[model samples]
Target chain A: SQQGEEDPQALSIQEGENATMNCSYKTSINNLQWYRQNSGRGLVHLILIRSNEREKHSGRLRVTLDTSKKSSSLLITASRAADTASYFCATAPSGGYNKLIFGAGTRLAVHP
Target chain B: DAGVTQSPTHLIKTRGQQVTLRCSPKSGHDTVSWYQQALGQGPQFIFQYYEEEERQRGNFPDRFSGHQFPNYSSELNVNALLLGDSALYLCASSGGTSGRAYNEQFFGPGTRLTVL
Candidate 1:
């Protein structure tokens, strides 16, 4: 079964605006990673935050993990039309680190 | 250096037929994993391979099987396919001491499989 669940099935925003997506999981995780997919193609690895990490940043991407709440959030600052895509949250379960479980995902549209 | 690679960018097959998808891991990687993504949904883990063994599997049935070659490349074989099996198949590879998924994974372009 899918371990992670995301909110805001879809989001639309203008360029230069910040977009945030949230994800919640049911089980404990060793790590949580985010990925972006364009159309229906391959997924592009984004930032990953360990269970112990509260926040991390890579360029305009910022991710936060709250283990206490079993949730994580991804924030894209100053969005661009090129940033339009589907974003997913994946978790490496504490019980089985070899299997990555993913959430449904959020479709983001950045309009110029 | 080249990243992970997969063959036959797209494929089409009929229900009840079988299909094989291949993947070559990135340089220095020895573990391969597979996932199935339905339209408008996140990718679901199918299985993971290491040392030419089926190390771990997901909720998929026995019909979904895979093998890892000595070279670290892998193949995912689906027998008696169903229409629901039609989806994008993704291959991911990582280099870890125990072939664990906790490490960052490099993904291939994925093969689009359509079942009629």
Candidate 2:
């Protein structure tokens, strides 16, 4: 079953602009992670935020989690053309931590 | 160190035939997980292996199964395949020592399966 659902199935933005994507999940999770997948390539781990963490940042990426609302958002600051890719949010259910249930990703196109 | 690596980058099989996809985990990693991603959709977890055992599994039926070798490599096998089974099969690896909150998964370029 799909655990997470990402909003704004697709987004287009110019370089240097900020891009944001939101995710909502059905059940409680131990942690939420964000990954980036280039065209026809594997997914790369980006950032992870625990249930207790309200927000976290890594370089140009900022992730916010609200366990109460079962929602999260990923923000990319100063988006670059290289940052264009499909971004997905995955949630590991509280009890089953080994497998991740992913969301339908948001495709972001950063035009240079 | 090499990241997760999968074999048979692309494969073609007919409905009702079986297929096997291989994966080698990153050095020093022991856990392996498999996922299926259909066109324009998110990946759905199939199962996971650790310590040469099936540690966890998702909602997939018995037709889908996997095995982990002593070397920490794994293979996903789909039996009695159906046309709807065609998708990109992904292999991911992560260390078991890292707690749930800190574990980071490394994924390999998925194997694109085309079921005719």
Candidate 3:
């Protein structure tokens, strides 16, 4: 079973527009990380936000976490055509092991 | 520094046969983990190896096993392959266990495995 679930299975937007993807998880996590994957390829780590932190930013990427709600959201500002890919949210449990539990993911399409 | 690398970009095996996939961790990394991603789904954790020992595992069956060499490279072996076992096998590497520092995992290109 998957611990995290991403919403809006798919999304499409213009190059200069902003894209937002949401993820909800069942268990408590020490941190939540977002990754991007091209077709049939491995994942690239985007950003990681710890449970203690409410928000984090990297370049044009912004991530917000609400531990109380057990949810997180990733926002890409000024999206580019190259940003088209699948985005996955993964959660690392508070303790036990450092393994990551990933969500199905959100397919984002950015058009020029 | 070289990133994580997996052997045999692609492979095919029969239903009753077995297959072995290899992975070399990135420079400065000491831990390796494996994942299986099916079409249109997220990657599922298979297991993790550190210090030449199996540290943690997911809900996979005993048929899925792995080994970590002294050099920190690893291999994933699947016995009695099934059609449902077909998927992209991904290998990720990270630094050794730190006291809850939230290490980031770097991934390899992955090997596409198909079972007939």
Candidate 4:
């Protein structure tokens, strides 16, 4: 079964707009990570936020995790057309192997 | 350093036939994992290999078996393939550690397997 589920299956916005995506999970997790994938390409690891951490930032990518709610969100600020891709949230279950369970991803379209 | 690499960017096979997909992990990485992604859906975990052993497996059946070489590269073999088995096969590499917090996995360009 899938552990994480992302909301807003699709989103479209003009360039320079910020894109935010949400992910909710069922079970307790040690960490939540986000990835980006271009069409017909491999997934690129973006950011990882641990359970102890509330928020993290890498360049223009910002991620927040709320263990109390078992949810997390990814924010891409000042989005550009090159940022158009599918974003996924993955959860590493607590007290188990570090295998990552991925969510069904949100597709973002940045129109230039 | 090269990221993960997969062979045969695309392949075509018939139902009931067998297929073998290969992957080479990133340099200095010892763990390899495989995933299957269908159209319009997220990638599903197939199994993971560590130290040349099947460390953990997903809900996939026995038909989907894999082997990891001493060098850490791995192969995913699917026997008696079905049409539904056709999907993009992705390979990811990471260091083998249990509780080290953030261990980001690097992925390879997936192999598009088409079953006819």
Candidate of highest lDDT: 3
Docking class of 3: medium
A54-107: candidate 1 lDDT, tens digit per residue: 999999999999999999999999999999999999998886745689999999
TM-score for chain B of all predictions:
0.95, 0.95, 0.95, 0.94
Q: Give the runs in model 4 whose Cα sits over 4 Å from its true position.
A: B96-102
Superposed Cα deviation of residue B44, candidate 4 (Å): 0.7
Q: Note the DockQ of each predicted structure.
A: 0.74, 0.70, 0.72, 0.67
Candidate 4, pairs of clashing residues:
none
Among incorrect, acceptable, medium and high, the docking class of model 1 is medium
**Candidate 3 root-mean-square deviation in Å:** 1.1
Task: Report the C-alpha lDDT of model 3 over A6-107, residue by residue, as the tens digit.
Answer: 998999999999999999999989889999999869899999898899999999999999999999999999999999999999998887456889999999
RMSD list, candidates in order: 1.0, 1.4, 1.1, 1.3
Question: Per-residue CA lDDT of candidate 2, range B1-116, in tens?
Answer: 78899999999999999999999999988889999999888899999888888878888999999999999999999999999999999999987574243477889999999999
lDDT of each: 0.92, 0.91, 0.93, 0.91
Clashing pairs in 1: none
Q: List residue ranges in candidate 2 displaced over 4 A.
A: B98-102
Estimate, for each residue in B19-109, the C-alpha lDDT of model 1 and write its tens digit. Answer: 9999999998999999999998899999999899987888899999999999999999999999999999999998657666478887899
lDDT of 3 at B115: 95
What lDDT tens digits, residue by residue, belong to model 4 across residues B1-116? Answer: 89899998999999999999999999988889999999888888998888888988899999999999999999999999899998999999988554233478889999999999
Instruction: Estimate, for each residue in B8-94, the C-alpha lDDT of model 3 and write its tens digit.
Output: 899999998999999999988888999999999999999998888998999999999999999999999999999999999999998
Lowest lDDT sum, 10 consecutive residues, model 4 chain B, at: B96-105
